[model samples]
Target: MPYSRRAAVYDVEYTEERDVGFILGLVGQAAPSVLEVPCGAGRLSLRIAPYAGRLTVVDLEPEMVARTVAALEREGHGGRIRGRVADMRELRLEERFDLALIPREALQLLPPEEGRQALAAAAAHVAPGGRLAVDLATFLPVPGGAPDPDYYDPARTDGVWATDWIRTLSDGSQLVRQSAQHHDGMSIRFDLQYRVLQGGRVAEDWAAGMRLHRYSRGWIDDARPDGMAVEAVHGDYDGSDFTGDSPRLIALYRRGPAAGR
Candidate 1:
């Protein structure tokens, strides 16, 4: 989960334009205190901070945290936003927040057990009756039951070429590869290989395996900690109802009255 190098070009690959509005709308008009876990490059944090009474963001990668802080400073929110480096599974924040978020499938990067633990840690930081929102990619099998071929294209910026592909293993796990080449002959590539575990052994391979988990409502239900109740599920940022064919799964949970008070 080291995002040091990826942090350089993350925003280029993943833009916030599509999600920012929906997320902000979900924050409501209450000016609630906020906590963001795995706030890589501050894509959402920077925008959300303005709407929050207070904002605290944490990421495991120091480089990402630094980038987030720098971005906030550039936007004149340095004093308003707090950025820190911390592990989600072992989070130890002293205070709770009215809203806690683990957006962009950040929790999916961890293995199953650790993912559950991370959810619990996030739940612990949510004040009673507060809400925790988590976004996950829908767990749908690739169409046609075959891996897609690699795609090559020129990067948005001049003088760069990029290629991307996925390999689906027989057991349903995936291996994804993204590579970029500069006109000057400099190149960098990364692979996210995932293997399905059955009885603690590799069952198969799948795409974007390292960063994405094939998540479902049952998965979240299984990971729910004590005193937490699933409140809503959305198919996308628009607050649409979740369905089997939805591309993303957004779950909202409320902390029980007696929990995390």
Candidate 2:
């Protein structure tokens, strides 16, 4: 139930689909087999399926897996992909993939140790000479960030999309508040509160505490799995080289000859 309960609300809340172009560029036109771990609601999976000869999507929450499966079926990709529930840390599959992706900075949601295991698990299924990629966020709070609590800042403004992240979900509820509870050097915990309105009246209230771990290029290099050589590392979705001041860490790797040794 980590993320399933929020499945429907989550599907509609975050409308933006991300990293498609950069990811697709890596997939190329080879029509190679691809694997996506924790495929969030199939938003990205649908686009990748056409380029993949065989697409396999997996998620830890059954609700997310179901939503992904339903989406693939709706989009006519059911025959090529199946979304299954499996923890990224413990996931074990016999097949190796031409490209394996961990999108949405998912590893951030896990503790450091678990995050490392997740990377290893994904690497284990990558075909030798194939590729592995992960996108993560480790931003330093915008220098002198929003002065007001109600201010919702845009992550990046390409002019195409810009909105406060907490604007209520139109389908049912609004995230009324998000407060930080605790933080160490490694992770931060948050208390999220929401209210669902019915006919302008309060219908339901939702609240939960969540934690997110942090990562950087060095963090990834230290935990790098065997045979996976760094191909490229970007600071943002625009594919710029990563630097110390970069807002995000997106790493791409290729499994070389030493794989599986």
**What TM-score does each of the candidates earn?**
0.72, 0.83
Candidate 2 residue lDDT tens string, 54-152: 888998778888888887788887888866689999989988898999986678888777888999999999887888899887645435543111222
Candidate 1 minimal-lDDT segment of 10 residues: 146-155
Runs in model 2 lying further than 4 Å from the true structure:
29-31, 141-182, 258-261
Per-residue lDDT tens digits for candidate 1, residues 105-210, read: 6776676678899999998998888888888765443354321111223323433434454444344544344443222222222234334455556655443313
**Best candidate according to lDDT:** 2
lDDT of 2: 0.73
Cα RMSD, each candidate: 12.7, 5.5
> Per-residue lDDT for 174 in model 1?
46
Name the lDDT value of residue 123 in candidate 1: 87
